[model samples]
Target: MKKVGSFVGDWWRLVSPYFRSEEWPYAIPLLIGAIALTLGSVGLEVLFNDWSRRFYDALEKKDEAAFWREIMTFSWLAALFIAAAVTRYIVSPYLRLRWRRWLTGRYLAHWLDSRGYYRIELERTIDNADQRIAEDLRQLGEYTMQLLLGFISAVATLISFLFILWQLSGPLSLKFIGIDVEIPGYMAIAALLYAIVGTFLANVVGRRLISLNFMKQRYEANFRFGLVRVRENSEGIALYGGEQREMDMLNLRFADVFRNGWRVLFTEAQLTLYQAGYAQMAIIFPYLVTAPRFFAGAITLGVMMQTASAFGQVYTALSFFVNNYTAVAELRAVMDRLQGLQEASDKKPATAIAVEPQPGGRDIAVEAMTLALPHGQTLLADTTLVLSRGTSTLISGTSGSGKSTLFRALAGIWPFGSGRVHVPAGARVLFLPQKPYIPIGTLRDAVKYPDEHSAASDGEIVAALETARLGHLAGRLDEDTHWTNILSGGEQQRLAIARALVFKPDWLFLDEATASLDEVNEAAVYDALKRQLPGTTLVSIGHRPSLRQWHDRRLELQRTPGEAGRLVEGAAPA
Candidate 1:
């Protein structure tokens, strides 16, 4: 009971936000529509059950006219039932889809907000977040709809059928040693008891299924992610002839999936045995219990048939938990995963650095900054520096000298640090990594990315592309494709530069952004930046000697044994 309460609490915490959001306008109405339709369907079922007794009575009485009349009544009831079912079928899925859309949108917003996606990556506490957002959210929506509606329908049906069974079965009298004990609504009581036992045993047998299912989802997601990784890196793998190694690793991931899948299968098989047996016996159990009264001529054949049908309905309704154990288990699993992700996303990194804005200042300043690795190892020593306006500064550091990490700190994305990074208020800045991130869209959109494509005029976009020496791509601006896969590394870098030009920010920080290009193209790109964006303050991290001449000053990261890297400002060595 405690476990169940915890599960429900977690589920509500995750799901209640949507109904309270702007989506409530449509979500509430659709939910009410579905519920109303479900209730209508249940009403139709009650009418059909009553009709069944009449139809059977008409047949036994051998009254042709009465039988024909009941048939006509059944025709009307069946039609209404069909209409209710059809309407419910349409309304329910529509509700599910609407709810799913709202839920997916909400989750996407939270996951992407405030660099939560990047922080989640740095934290490394949540695995398969892509799956959590995409697959788990989908499952959460689908299963929530199914289980909620099924429960509502079951409760309504249980009440309706319990009354019918009470009326149809009447009382059963048992002779005690010296007195008679009368049990009222015996069929309802019997069905309730049967369902209770079935539910208890089902839980006992299927308790482990929850953790197994959790593992199964993780394993499946891991395997799928592996395949996607291989597909994305197919070029690298092919170039290195690492097909055999990748195949071996893929097989290893699949082994976990295969092992966990069989465990799920076996558990499901056990559950199915109990559920199937419970269901089959339910068919004859009602007849078995009531046969004595039927044989004694105490009730008519119609009454006997009615009693059995009512018992079945009542039992099925009460057995809702038993029948839906697997779905409930999966539902709990998805809820736990989404809840974990939500909690993890809410956490601010323990090593978060503070960035303050200096009003009316025209420079980016790092004051007494100390950056630490996750394990508390120092990456950068106390550093104080400023890059003023109209001066292009180059940062040169050996590998792992924390140049890129410093760029991240300045950009306000890197969290593991201390001290203040002061940026001029309302200043626009762009950070270009070594490998540019090309969103999956048109080349035009990718070039204008991080900003809407409409943010730039066609002429501006073409000019930026031409400045970055990518005039060949100007004609294909409207073409939609995966720019990452189609564009070569050098081309990607050039496009990133073009992207920077289109934005025309007040400051630009390049973290080995031009390293992928040859020296000629690299030098030409730097020259183009100076010519086109002369007013833009440029801070670049590079190793090429050719890059030193373009900048007025350079910051070099110098380190000795047992000490973190320190920034030293001087002229670049030509």
Candidate 2:
């Protein structure tokens, strides 16, 4: 019971938000209408059950006129049922679609906001968030509607038919131990017991399916991610001739998928075997239990048939859980994944460096900042630094000395740290990594990325590209393509520099951003920054000796064995 309550709470957490959202006006009405249709369908089934009794009795009595009359009656009931089903077909899917759209929007907003996506990746807290947002939300929306409506309909059917079955069943009188025993509503009792037993067995046989489905989703996502990685890194793979290695890795991922899939298939088959046998037996079990009354002429033909139909309805209603155990298991897995992602995204680190903005300030300051790796190893201890406006500073360090991590700390995305970083309020800051991110869009958009809505005119973009030595791409500003795949490494770097030029941020931090370019092009790009954005402070992380000449001050991260590195102001290496 406690577990059931917790599961309901988790489901409500995922479901109730949509109906309570801004779309509630539309969402609520559709939901109510769907429930109404489901109940109406159940009502139709009850009418059909009564009609079956009348029609069969008419045939038994050879009353042709009454038979035709019941046929006409059945025609109307069938029409209503068909109309209800058609309406449901339309209303249900549209409702699911609207709900999914709203949910997708909300998840996307949360995942993208405050760099939650990056932090999730950095901490390795959740896997395949894209799958959660895309596929799992889809399944949640569809299955919620399906199972909710189905359960409601089942309850309605049970209530409407249980009384009819009880009255039709009459009483079973038996002599036990020289005492007369009369059991009332014997057929209803039989159905209840039978369904209880079936449900228990179904659960016992399929209990492993929930975890299996969970692992199946993960394995499928991992395999798909592997394929996407191969496509994204196709060039590198080809350069190193690692096709066979990639194939082997992909085969390993798929082996998990195959092994888990076989387990799911075998388990489902066992459940299906029990359900199929249960249903087939249910077809004749009603007659078997009620046969003595009919044979003894205690009940009419119509009463016997009515008893059977009512028994079927009551039993089906009681067996809802047995029939839907597989779907329930799948939904549980989806809920677990989505809840995990929400929890992970909402979590905050115990100790994080504070990044505050200083209004009307002219410099950026990192005060006694302690940066660490995700594993709790201190990278930079008690590091204090300041970057004055209109100056260029080059930060150099040995490999793995936390230069890039410090850059992340300044950017306010690093969570494994403590202290404070104060940036000038309303200051525009840009950090260009070694491999620039070229969104799959127009050339102009790629250059104006991280600020897609910037009002930089095409002329300015062309000028920026020309300044960054990517003048060759200036003419193709409007061409939309996979800019990352089409652009060479050096060209992508130049495009990033073009972005820096266009945005003209108050501060620019480049972590080996120009490493792909030759010395001449690198120098040209740096000189252009000096000439075009003299007021912008330039902070760079690179080991090239040639880079020192571009900056006014050089800071190196000096480290000792078993101690965190510290930034030391030093002369540029000659």
Candidate 3:
């Protein structure tokens, strides 16, 4: 019971967003329309159940005219039913799409907001975010819609049909050896009782199926993520002769999936045995209960048939949980995943960058500060620093000595420890990482990313490329291709520099932005920056000591074993 309550709670949390969002106007109406149509369908079913009795009576009495009239009445009811069913069909898909759209947008916003994506990546968060967003969201919508409509229909049918069956069935007063055994509406009571017992037993036997299904989704996602990882890094793996290892690893994940899948299959088979048996028995149980009354001549054949139909409706209503057990289980899994992601995203507070505007205007400051990782491991400590305007500062240190980490702290992304990062308000800055991000678009859009494609002029873009010693790339700016895959590492780096030159940021920070380029090419890009934006401040992380000569100041993180890296002061006016 507690487990069931937990599942409902989680499901509500997952689903409430759509009804409360911008899509609610349309979503609510479509949902209400679908529900109304569902109720109408149920009403038609009850009417048809009532018709069954009259038709059967006409048959028993050999009344041809009466039978034909009943047939035509049934045809009219069938048309109404078709109309209701069609309305439900039309409204349901619209609601599903709108709900899915709202949910997808909400999840995307939460996942990407305020460097939450980066934090999740660093923390090795719940595996297969891609699957959660793509596959699970799709299933969540489809299954929820089906279950909701199915349940509503079941309830409506049960309530509407039960009264008619009661009148048709009359009463049951059985005497076993002269003792009274009074069962009122015996057929309906028996169907309800039978469904309750069956559903209860099914749940007891299939409780483990929930866990099995959850693990199956996880295993499938893990196996798929492994295969995708291999595909994405196939080139690197082949170069290092690691295909065998990757294949072995991928096979291991697949084996986990196979193992978990077996558990689900076995559990579901056990459930299927009970459910199929219960459903088959349902067809006859009504007739058995009403047979006595029929034999006694208390009711006609039509009443017997009507009793059977009503019994089926009651059984369906009571067994709603049983029939949809698998979907419920799957919904539980999706809820768990989405909730985890939501909690993780919400936990990361927005870290405000402490960029205090200075007297000299736009000078960056890190005053008596420290930066630690989310795990409480300090990356940089006791750092009192200032980067005045127009000064080219180079950050040099051994790899993993907190050079790039400090840059991240400065960028207001590494939200770990206490400190203020001060920069002048309204000052624009850009951080170019080791490997530049080449978006899937025209070279112009890739270069002018974070800004609209329409923001930068073609001549200005070409001029920036020419300045960065990537003049050859200028002619291809109009062409669209996967630039990251096609361009050499050095060329990509040069392209990033060209982007900086075009945007002319107030402060440009590059972490190993020139590592892939030859010394001459690196010098050419650096020379381009000096010539294009001599007044722009540059803070760069690089291991090549030869490049330090271009900077006016330096900051190095001194590393020690078992101790956090500390930023020490250095000379200026290089």
Candidate 4:
């Protein structure tokens, strides 16, 4: 009972949001419509139960005309029952689609808003986001529709049928050890009690399934994520001959899935043994209980048949929870995941980046800045620096010396820092990481991205591409497709250069953005920057010795293995 209470409370927490959301007007009406259809369906069920009595009685009495009449009556009643059922499910898919759209949009907004998604990745362990959005939302939408409608119908069936069953049962004579006690309508009470017991036991045995299924989903997603990562990095792993290691790691992840799946199958099989057998026995239990009285002619055959049908309805209604244990538990787990994700995505801003826009000066300054890792390990200390507007600089450092981490700090993404950076108003700062993001869309949107699709005309976009020496891609501006897989690393970097030119930002930070390109391509891209964006400030972090001549100022990070990171000086180009 306590466990059941907990689940009910949690389910309400998860379910109440949708009904109260901005879409509630449409949702509420459809919900009420579905519930009404369910109630009508149950009512038809009751009428059909009553019809079974007369029809069976007519058969037993060998009354041909009456039998035909009863059959015709049952046919119409069945038709009405089916129509009600249809209404209940007719709008079900539409409702599911709408609800999913609302929920997915909500998640997306929350995840992307205010750097919440980035913080969640840094600070929390909520993985399988794709699965959460796609699989969980799909299941939640469909299950809520099916389960809520079923609950309504079950409640109505219980109320309507329980009354008919009590009245029809009249009196049930209890017998044990040759002793007999007669009680009014006691058979209805017996069936109710039996159903309640079965429901309780089923819950006790199946309650752990919620956590199990939750873990199962996680493991499956992890396995799939492993495969996706492999597919994405196939070239690198193959180059390093790491296929065997990758296979072993993937197997370990999937092993969790296999073991948990076996456990579920084992337990589910046992549950089916009892639940299926219990339900099957119910079909005959009613007839058997009333058989003696039926034989003794305590009532007509019609009453007997009606008593059996009513008993069936009462039991089925009472056993609803037992039947839906899996779905209910799985839904609860999904709710927990979504709630956790919402919390993770909405995490509070860590100590704010002490960076500001300079009022009249065209310069970037860092004063008494301290950079730390997420766990409070100081990576850089007492760093004060200034880069005037229109000055080109290069940041150089050894392997794993917190150079990239410093870039993150300067960009205001690495929040484990205390510093002030001021850029003049209207100065757009663009950071191009080694792995530039290529959004799936027309080439124009990818190039002029984070900009509206209509912001740049085709001529301007093509001209910008030509300036970046990516004239080959200029013709594909209007084609909507995934360019990430199609473009080579060198071409992608060239396109990144196009983005810098098209946006015409005041400051551009290139974090090894030209690493994959040949010297000719790299020098060509740099020349394009000089020609097209002469007044823009350029700061780059790279390891290539050949990149030294492109900048006028240099900064570096040096770290001994297992020691803290520190700033060091490097050569500055004239």
Which candidate gets the maximum lDDT versus the true structure?
Answer: 2
lDDT (C-alpha, whole model) for all candidates:
0.87, 0.91, 0.81, 0.83
Greater lDDT among 1 and 3 belongs to 1
Compared with the true structure, the alpha-carbon lDDT of candidate 3 equals 0.81
lDDT of 4 by residue, 342-440 (tens): 777777755656667777867888787877777777777778888777778888888778888878877877766787777676678899888888999
- What does candidate 3's lDDT look like per residue over 138-234, in tens digits? 8889988888889888888777766766666666776756868876776667767887898889888888876777788789988988887887676
Reference-based TM-score of each model: 0.96, 0.98, 0.95, 0.93
Candidate 1 off by > 4 Å: 176-180, 453-455, 560-563, 572-574
Candidate 1 yields a Cα-based lDDT of 0.87
For candidate 2, lDDT tens digit of each residue in 162-215? 988988998877774565999999888889999999999998999899999999
TM-score, structure 4 vs. true:
0.93
Error of 3 at 268 (Å): 0.9
Global CA lDDT computed for model 4: 0.83
lDDT of 2 at 487: 84
Model 4: CA > 4 A from native: 174-181, 354-361, 418-420, 561-571
Question: For every model in order, what is the number of clashing pairs?
Answer: 0, 0, 6, 2
Of 1 and 2, the candidate ahead on lDDT is 2
